[model samples]
Target: MTAGPYPPSMIGLSDVPVSNLAPPTGALVALAVAQFAAISWLGRRCEPALATDRWRRFLDDGNAPLMTVYLWHLPAMVLLVGAGLLLPDLILPDAGLHWWLIRPLWLANCALILVVLTRLWHRFETVRLPALGTRTGPATALAGTGLAAASIWYLWQHGATLNGAGSAGRIAAVLALGCSLVLLACGQPRTRRDAPVRGPELNVHPVRSGPAA
Candidate 1:
């Protein structure tokens, strides 16, 4: 990481053209292969820890809000960096020894912001909305899913706000995405165990509730 092409000496990759990123050759290819091998070896060594309760819970909690973490990390960094611009006198250059010294401070700030963002939206990760289990529901869900995917693709390619123009397209995309979510929440399938039993003759189960009937 310290080997980056930073300031006073070289142009950063972000400033370079896409064509400049040539495919890996020779030593680079060997390095990539070695990384893969190392990862496989580490995974094998870590596998046994999964059986332990501590590791299991750690993995479970970390994974449950992973998408939230992934989505907000870059945004959090952007927010912090943008705020830093307000303190022009105190801010350091994008590279150099002084800038490198503050790297840990930047990472700490980003981590705090990410934690708050994750707390704000983590409930959505485990949300369970009731959905119809009928054939019609499945069809509607599929249609909505397709529409949502198309809208996301368009938005991703053209930016979410669209340079503050094409209000109609933006509105349509937002509406389509919202409708797709509704369709998904109200039309997704349910398994047999999720269905309620009906027209039963008797409550024969000894542990049945309802006034000890």
Candidate 2:
């Protein structure tokens, strides 16, 4: 779907030749616009229902652990798919007669794996953030992000191992990644012992009458 004009996408849903087709640029653009319009209309229609406290809580329940799901979902899928390779007999061929039947099983297994992963990592999404080791400026944060992105791009182009051709580059990339993490970990200001908030002494206090008035 991504390849433009000349090489309009030839990919299919599966090994099914019936599903093969190319999407024209005009069609893709029009479809995208249509989708946006539909979503806008739906959002407007749903706002009143969604504004209720019950719906808000429901939305929050689904959204609160979304980050955890986003982080672990790909890994969970990769692990399951890789593990499937070891049990080839259980997996059907693409577009095979039993493939459709097995799809639900695949989804169920992936969901089970995702649930376990969510249980393990979702706490990070819900937990209160801890203080940073040191306060950092935007420049530091930007530098860290650039370094981290560069490291990922570098390794994605070269290889991760430092045993071969691009060894030096890979090593540099790893170092960049480490430095980025250090910079990113430094945003929190150090806690002062004389801090003015967040305790019975600050947010809450009891008044005492002077010497029985």
Candidate 3:
């Protein structure tokens, strides 16, 4: 999982001295901004009906199924992989598969997990929680929760290998996930209410009859 330089020992649980962790250039920031713009554009184009949406409104109205799906997918993949490892050799004989084919198997497992989770999500409507209060507050809370959880998981799983690139990727992924949660929270649908009608008085005008007379 380690990519790029900085040594494998630099990763893992070490009280390494603090140093400059900045990327080589401002390219990373520019890339992040570009990504955000692209995502915003795609959101508008894809969800035209919800174009005028706010993140808080979306979260409050209980329409964040994808967030749940994304959150659960990783764990599901881990479980599936573990189960696959335990399966009888006859069924999924590991005939010295190449690394390229192994990657495909991993992706297939992840996809299967997502499909199963999606079905479960549909059945329970767990994604549709009532808007608890102000959209910003709840959305922030959810983002914080997701970030904290992701951070803990990253440290636990890849703490030893968290070099510059890994750290950057982890931070980017967590931020993206947090933003998605916020968007989902803000994009909840509003409930419809009946509006009262006002009564009006009628006025009549008489036409001139000079020609007839």
Q: How many backbone clashes does every candidate have? A: 0, 1, 15
**Model 2: CA > 4 A from native:** 1-35, 137-146, 159-168, 187-213
Which ranking of candidates, highest lDDT first? 2, 1, 3
Q: Which model, 1 or 2, shows the larger TM-score?
A: 2
TM-score of each: 0.62, 0.64, 0.36
Ranking by TM-score: 2, 1, 3
Query: Which candidate achieves the best TM-score against the true structure?
Result: 2
* Span of ten consecutive residues with least summed lDDT in model 3: 16-25
Better of 1 and 2 by lDDT: 2
Worst 10 residues of 1 by lDDT: 4-13
Q: Write the per-residue lDDT of candidate 3 for residues 62-148, one digit (tens) a residue.
A: 665677677778788778767767764622455665545666776877888887887777567664576743334566667666766
Tens digits of lDDT, candidate 1, 73-181:
8889898989889975456465678788888987899999999999988887668854454434658868888989998977754557744678678778888898887
Q: Candidate 1: list runs displaced more than 4 Å.
A: 1-38, 92-94, 123-127, 130-138, 188-213
Candidate 3: where is the Cα deviation over 4 Å? 1-31, 40-64, 87-97, 125-213
The residue-by-residue lDDT of candidate 2 on 1-213, one tens digit each, is: 435443334344334332223334465566679999999999999999899999999999998778888899889889888988988667634777677888899888888999999999887667877666657778998999999999998886565888777798899899989999989888856568536677555565788778974
> 67, model 3: CA deviation in Å?
1.7
